[model samples]
Target: MSARFVQQLPHRRERVADWFARPGAVTRLTPGAAPLTPRAAAADLAAGETVFAMPVGLSWRARHDPAAFIPGRRFADEVVNAPWRALTGWRHVHELADSRGPGGAGTVVVDRIRARVPAAALHGLFAFRHTTLAGDLAAADRLAGVLGIGAGVGREPGERLPRLTIAVTGASGTVGTALVALLGTAGHEVIRLVRGAAAGPGERRWDPEAPAADLLEGVDALVHLAGAPIAGRFTEAHLAAVRDSRVGPTRRLAEAVAAAGTPVVVSASAVGYYGADRGGEILDEDAAAGPRTEALAGIVADWEDAWAPARAAGARVALLRTGLVLAGGGGLLPPLAGLTRACLGGRLGSGRQWFPWIALDDLVDLYHRAALDPALAGPVNAVAPGGVDNAAFTRTLAEVLRRPVGPPVPAAGPALLLGRRGAAELALADQPAVPARLVSMGHVFRHPGLAGALRHELLRPAPERG
Candidate 1:
């Protein structure tokens, strides 16, 4: 049987086709929720080429049919081998064409396939594919606008960004995973610094408490993301772990990088530095940190201060004071989305408290900018331009999920579940952080508004939330 799907994007056909023709197209097209990892990619979709992957612990390989290839228009891939090969014949075709409408010139993308699998089972996958493609195109267009460049202008031959050997700690965490994938796609050499045994040449063991003296040797840049999560119930031990993990490990890594002469260091931080009780004040990068009495705020202040060694050694340091990151797998979205879908969603406590949030993709891009831009040193507030309060956040999320906004959830439930301090700090913080520096530098946010971000993160398929 055959299945077909079509999607329209606000870009010319050539531009969309060129994007698909690039080397990392498959990596980009695959959902962030997929369990698949590209093992070997075809340089281009030319005839007789193949791309291999490991999907859910199984080896998957697809071969291109020379006779089915049509330059600039279409290409077809056939599943060559699989455990289900006897039961399914998977032949997929991708086609692109130009179109015009009230929205102006654009492109129409169509995916047609003949497979033995049930059509119903294929629907969600194709829908996810289309949505992801559309989102990527939108990001590219937005980035083009940010850079003041013409959209769809292909990079000239031999024109490439300078790549560096970048070492990253906490490579398994949320932001680290996203950042590593992005860096790999951009042709940088990412050496994962892990706490476990070194798996291969790509990974090196690191002990944050006592890093190897030569750990930073030959590394052009470093990103420090190793810290205990701050989401659990705020018990005395939990709070101490948070503080200890951040302060000691950060200082150790910063000192090592500095002594090794690493050129730059990008360390993870949080908006919690601004204190959990700020009212309507507009907090920027230069804003004074929260008082010492606030546990989380004090920890963040110490975390940022730990980078002093690197800065003093002439290494540029950037502290990413990130806000609420909206993504599928983790962060504050899962619980909130769960409650919203169950029709139990509502503003927390006073709903009037400002919520500072950033899109997952935007946060990843901010990390990239921090690493590559020379002017981005010091503390940078990694939040969206406009701030939304708790009420609007709840309303937007409910509207996106087609759920009703229930009554405001008083602080009692969260406080009881996550302890008073955790509830007050995370669920009820009111800092309205603005990306003033990034804005002044002409940085663009792919999902600047809550509606778009919600749709992208919540509605998108996450078969495997990796």
Candidate 2:
């Protein structure tokens, strides 16, 4: 099967310069090179690197192009190690077409991955599977920076910022509201999704349980963060709510977007989807779900699967498997803070289970990246790249709060004290994860490491993680 994509610039001077000039300050704006031949060097946009285009997920890599043709007018790469064997190969081609507008219009270019594989099987299996194709996508994505394209252009007097629009589901939730407030402040047009009639100026409406799907029009990007909270025990009712909260609304949103047409979809998922990574090794996106945790992990797998309609309709999708988000008001900060302050907190269980944690601010930034980055899609491990042992986590927190880290709590302590709710989570375990996909997309983490991350955001305003 084939895929076609097109992008444009207002004038010609943006893309072609001597057919290839490596995008110098003067060369990036040579002022006549319409239909610019995008530059790809030995390390820039070359063979054997991953790229995160919309159709392909965040981990999509580039295969060596036997047809690069030295100084050609395009850059292309294919998926060499796709997860599926049914698909022979997936080629990503970026071409610049001539523009009839002013300033010698040039397009950033359109990237298309045409595959020789069978569509039915690959679609049924992994629609946008591109991760294992290469080891590093960042080195390749950084190619754009070298070309002096987009942000590389710097500011030539009246430089136009890339148009950024943020679409949020559950705009009324505590976290959702925070996202809307931040996105709006960043000067982005924030579009909110509502259940009833579309009410506000920056809002749209759709109900997942409705008999008919609704319209998902004009949204360049989306963030599916709408889901009911499972605060109480995992009762049958709660389990159904948990599963449906994500899958139901997701299906409705996906179908609506299918009809109305949009570009990218970045949705939320949970680390619980990993279902207790008892295996010692870290679980990257490619890790298979273990049998013990299949039921829980299947929820995530199914949640992600529901987006197939949108994917088939040609919308890029990203599934974010977020860990324990450490925000001030939401998820876990309050209890952790209070327990430690009262000098009651200690390592839970064997203190060996891995705790994957992410700073709240970093979590927000992750959402922004998923919404804005044209390259990211598919499964992205949203936790900070580092995973600490439970003891290590407690020690780190104690050190940060200037407290002692002793008096180990037994495995049954949680069960005896707080009941099964606390015991179930503590008894189970997981391993580390790398935000490999995000880093590959050129995201510089404000909180890449832990101690510093805790010191700043938890203490003073964390310095810009730019």
Candidate 3:
């Protein structure tokens, strides 16, 4: 049985066809909300070409038939060898033509599928596909003018890289969880370095203090994100734990990587290297580590220096000097949102301290970029463009949550909760850092501004204005 579905796009035939013919068309067309993920995109509609993909829990490969391909007119992908191949007759043909609606400028797209699957069951998939295609096209058109790069610039699309074996130390943490999910979906094999006994193919027991040289023998890259959480009531023991978790573990990992001859190592750092008192300085990656009196500053300096072994062993090293990450699940947003919901959300201390923030998505992308971009070596500031002050951050959060802004909280409150030094350094600290290297390298941000970031992280509707 076969069925066809068609939709009109407010674009010319050539325009729509050109987009479909681009490198990243499949990735752009894949809905973000869907569980289906593209591991490799079809570079062209050549016969026998296959697009590797994964559907949540299964691997899939969609093979193209040369006989059915008509450049700028139609192309079809038949299930060559996929989990879905067990189903009878599965082939999807994509067609595009100029609409004859007097203007002759509009494009009509048709999806003809021959499958035993019911149209009722497959309707949602096509709907999602069409909607994603239209939305991506519209977004490209809107950003074309300001970016100076018209929809002409093609996206790389999907995980074009060959499969790699990656070992991640903090595979259970916030950033780790997100990164692992992406890598797995992209068809990369991830070996999690667990402290517990290894129980599976993708698990390995790691003792940072005494790592085996052969532990990472065949691993292509290592991402070490395991560290004690920085946000807490800082105490002597807590500070020691923080320093121990970062510096010693990093040193051991670097040593192991050196012995194992791993090609690359991406270790985490923090913008706290700038210290808590660099008033009004627009710090960049070149800025020197600030006062040794500042605990975080000193720790981050050692933490970054701890990667020397990896670099000395000929492994390319990238230090991500990350900033405040705005995300829904973890990071700085949840407690702040709680405060806002309780009507206690307000500026801290003098409300003049600079706050460097990056959206969780952008941060994750930056990590991915750092791992791949060969030019990105040394310290790269992982932050968005606009550095907001504490007051602006508070106001934006309140606005996003649609809560009334409250008076500024005194320093004593945070000092008591987070310890005096921690409050002074983190809550009331002022370091205006920027992603100078990322900007120069032409990195794009998903949420560059404070308001947009808050809305995205909080999942809130756009704020109303008078």
Which candidate gets the maximum lDDT versus the true structure?
1
Q: Model 3 over residues 1-466: C-alpha lDDT tens digits?
A: 7889889987667667766765445654553334455566666775655554465567667888788888888889988664578775688898988776763357889999998888766565675556546644553343333234433233322313445788989977767766665455444678899998997887899998898767897898898899999888889988999999999989999989988999878878899999998768889999878998889999999999999989998989999898998866667888889889999998998899988998765676666556655677899999999789999999988987889988789989898889999898788889899999988867777678988767655555353377
Please give, for residues 57-137, the per-residue lDDT of candidate 2 as tens digits: 423344557466344356676664555323556765666555555553443445465677554433311211111001012
Q: List the lowest-lDDT window of 10 residues for candidate 1.
A: 151-160
RMSD per candidate (Å) reads 5.4, 20.5, 9.5
Task: List TM-score per model, in order.
Answer: 0.81, 0.62, 0.69
Q: Weakest 10 consecutive residues, lDDT, candidate 3?
A: 151-160
* TM-score, candidate number 3: 0.69
The lDDT ranking, best first, is 1, 3, 2
lDDT at 15, model 1? 63
Q: After superposition, how far is residue 256 of candidate 2 from its true place, in Å?
A: 0.9
Task: Write down the lDDT of every candidate, Cα atoms only.
Answer: 0.79, 0.58, 0.77
Tell how far residue 184 is off in model 2, in angstroms.
1.7
Task: Show where candidate 3 strays beyond 4 Å.
Answer: 1-159, 463-466
Model 2 stretches astray by more than 4 angstroms: 1-160, 196-199, 211-214, 292-295, 416-422, 425-427, 460-466
